[model samples]
Target: MTASPSAARGLAARLADGPVICAEGYLFELERRGYLQAGAFVPEVVLEHPERVTALHEEFVHAGSDVVEAFTYYTHREKLRVIGAVDLLEPLNREALALASRVAADTGTLLAGNICNTNVYDPADPASADRARAMFTEQVGWAAEAGVDYVIGETFGFLGEALVALEVVREAGLPAVITMNLHEAPRTREGTELPEAMRRLADAGASVVGLNCGRGPATMLPLLAELVDAVPVPVAALPVPYRTDAAHPHFQALVDEAYPGLPSGRPFPTALDPFTCNRYEIADFARAATDAGAHYLGLCCGAAPHHVRAMAEALGRTPPASRYSEDMSRHVYFGSDPTLARLNLEYGRTL
Candidate 1:
């Protein structure tokens, strides 16, 4: 009466293959909700309004998210050092994972540890790569210890950084997903082609790979199609809010007038008036992603719970009920700084 191993794996694959709705980054979503003022990163705001982190996760779960990413995207030790919270990295990472886990357990969803870019892009310097690798390994280890089911490396602009992150997640023995932010040309920031990036990430040991946090879906469809043809693993698309060329100046002035203490010095772009995309547009994006070989569909910035619901309805399936464990190690690799040869060896044995 027991299911075969292949059958079980098949079921797990199906569940993991479906759409994975996203809640926007903690700081961005909270700012939109008016829970936190603009111009601050999640870690800084977490120190003052920690509960907002938990609330954001809960909201996404209620909105039918199959997976809820931990709010630790910017909690890396190096970034924390810049913010004078170097000592708080461990606590914040652990707390963020624990909070996401707790909410996932309660809502029957999965938790993905959010591993973001190092926020330091210096192509001329090899040291930046070393530092980025170190930070990624440390954060992935912490996520493993804190019990995250998968490490979701989101918003990476460069393929090299994504490779480093994939290596770290592989070494930690965890499922890993990589989302690249697309430029106007549909290439990564480093100028690597999307198809090439897909091949490299799959070879580097990523379970899921796709595009997220770029220009709106309208601009991302062709890129998604290219990615679909390049990788055998499940793909995903998470587009952010559109940029309004006409109103950007006005919005920047309004944000400056409203929040003079903004840290990044970049003027706030006008918030999409929530009507940027209607249900039909949202459904069309989801349908295109699904048709283009993106098994996982969701929204990034400017996407709300209504979008999630609409996408789910478009797919004609409810969110999966199984919860994801941080320790599963379904398709992971481990080591401090493993070379590609070593990664290939590790991957071969796992297969």
Candidate 2:
């Protein structure tokens, strides 16, 4: 199941050929597996249960992810400090990167180290920016030592924080894939338009820039189209696999009318099962994103192996997992096989 060393290519080089899928949202996915908590969302699972992390990476690779991104989304120093496990910061990040590296090597997929929004970044506070910079520097340094193909800076809602990440990644001399998270408004939290913000990242040497998380295909696509026109570099679009419409542009804003009185009053993080997109919708998103000039495509939170497989197939790739793709022809009632009972097939209409 491993690709030869000769077949390995860098992220940008692979992007030149066609779409590159980087499966993200590890925090949410692992939380569902019960290894990690949802509230803190820290990836202590990287150290607590290394095997589970490795298994998830391999699953994503087999399902057709072109990149095995480290599960260090919220493993930064600030998040660790909040959970009173600041000492576990370096060890957790290194472990996550090591786990992802092994899977990427085995599957011949690109290896990526990750950095995400530091909840501390505030444009009005220069000290907060300093703390964010230090966090990015340390994480990017570890990723470089781990010899990742690139560093992915995602889910950033503030342009200032994203710029800090880009600078740190650049300082480490690694290709940077910087993406922002739009919360309801098309503009960043700092009041910058998405296209202009992406342009700034691209101009500042980001290899790829676009949007990730906080929106679904319906809401993310329009913003993606704008970025493609603004930035000359290949755009990245990884949306949450949810049915977010204009009324509910962000998953957090989605009102679960069925459960009018939920504790948190929101379906995000958990209890979003009712709003999840089916495999067909993900496939449609893949096709549309490709046509809209987004060479880097994937699902953010709520992504599963089947969704990844569907995306790869929609991009005209038959990944290893595609072998088990749905075969309606073999079904008992809707099957086209002649050997099936005609009576059962006829009675399927009533059922």
User: TM-score for every candidate vs. truth?
Assistant: 0.77, 0.97
What are the lDDT scores of the predictions, listed in order? 0.68, 0.89
Residue by residue across 29-105, what tens digits does model 1's lDDT show?
Answer: 66676665443364655556668778777766665677767778778877787767688887788777777777766
Candidates in order: C-alpha RMSD to true structure: 17.1, 2.1
Kindly give the number of clashing pairs for every candidate. 6, 0
Candidate that scores best on TM-score: 2
After TM-score superposition, the amount by which residue 25's alpha carbon in candidate 1 deviates from its true location, in angstroms, is 3.7
The deviation in Å at residue 186 for candidate 2 is 0.8
- Can you write out model 2's per-residue Cα lDDT over 246-330, one digit (the tens) per residue? 9999999888889977777788768899999999999999999988889999989989888999999999999999999998876
C-alpha lDDT (0 to 100) for residue 3 of candidate 2: 27
Query: CA shift at 174, candidate 1, in angstroms?
Result: 0.8
